[model samples]
Target: MVTVPELEGTFIEVETLVEEADLSEGPAAVRGVLAELNISEDAFTTEQYTDAVIAHRSA
Candidate 1:
């Protein structure tokens, strides 16, 4: 688990592995699960957790 003051609450990382031919479906599939979990698309971020942690500690 990781905690960053810049973000609210805890974060959960989800990923899907897909073949190169079906690579486009990766994001869609993850978004589908996020939707079912009531998580908004606006909350999606591509920031690395390690970077967030480093910045948080620096502050």
Candidate 2:
């Protein structure tokens, strides 16, 4: 499961994968999670979000 840690100045988002699912299911899952969180698609790049998650965990 994916865990997106909270960032002080940014929205937190994450994508988790289940062994039974395929990669194609990722986008829709991400979109649904983002929608639920009210995050706009253009607000953060995949790379940026990834970095934030890493930084938060390491901190």
Candidate 3:
């Protein structure tokens, strides 16, 4: 499962693979998924997403 915390100024699409996969190999799988969707790590920061999530939860 992928957990993409929302950010105020950035948008990210979430996806899940139906095939069985090992959790230990999830990093590479996530990278592949991001690449497939053209997503970048620099697109959103932890602080930004944390703030967004907190604001959303409070609301």
Candidate 4:
């Protein structure tokens, strides 16, 4: 879990492996599951997290 102090917000990222062709259905599936559990996205991001992981591995 990570926190954004200024926004007083917190979030946990859930990841799944999906084929490139299934990219569209992937998000739909995730959103459907989230909706079933009453969860929502306030600020969804992939670029930042991907960059962070790459930088950390290089470091």
The top-ranked prediction according to lDDT is 1
Candidate lDDT (C-alpha), each: 0.84, 0.70, 0.60, 0.65
Ranking the candidates on TM-score from highest down gives 1, 2, 4, 3
Taking the tens digit of each residue's C-alpha lDDT, what string does model 1 give over 1-59?
A: 45667755778688899999999999999999999999998888898977877777798
Please write out the lDDT profile of model 2 over residues 12-51, one tens digit for every residue. 6576785565877878888889888888888656567568
The predicted structure with the larger lDDT, 1 or 3, is 1
List model 4 lDDT by residue over 15-41, tens digit each. Answer: 667899888888887777666767766
Give the Cα error of residue 4 in candidate 3, in Å: 12
Decide which is better by lDDT, 1 or 4. Answer: 1
Model 2 alpha-carbon drift over 4 Å, by segment = 1-8, 48-59
Q: How close is candidate 4 to the true structure, as a TM-score?
A: 0.47
Error of 4 at 36 (Å): 2.8
For model 3, residues 21-52, the per-residue Cα lDDT tens digits are 56556567766777777777666344545676
Query: Which one is best on TM-score?
Result: 1
The residue-level lDDT of candidate 2 at 38 comes to 82
| Candidate numbers, best lDDT first, in rank order | 1, 2, 4, 3
Candidate 3 TM-score over all chains jointly:
0.40
Worst 10 residues of 4 by lDDT: 4-13
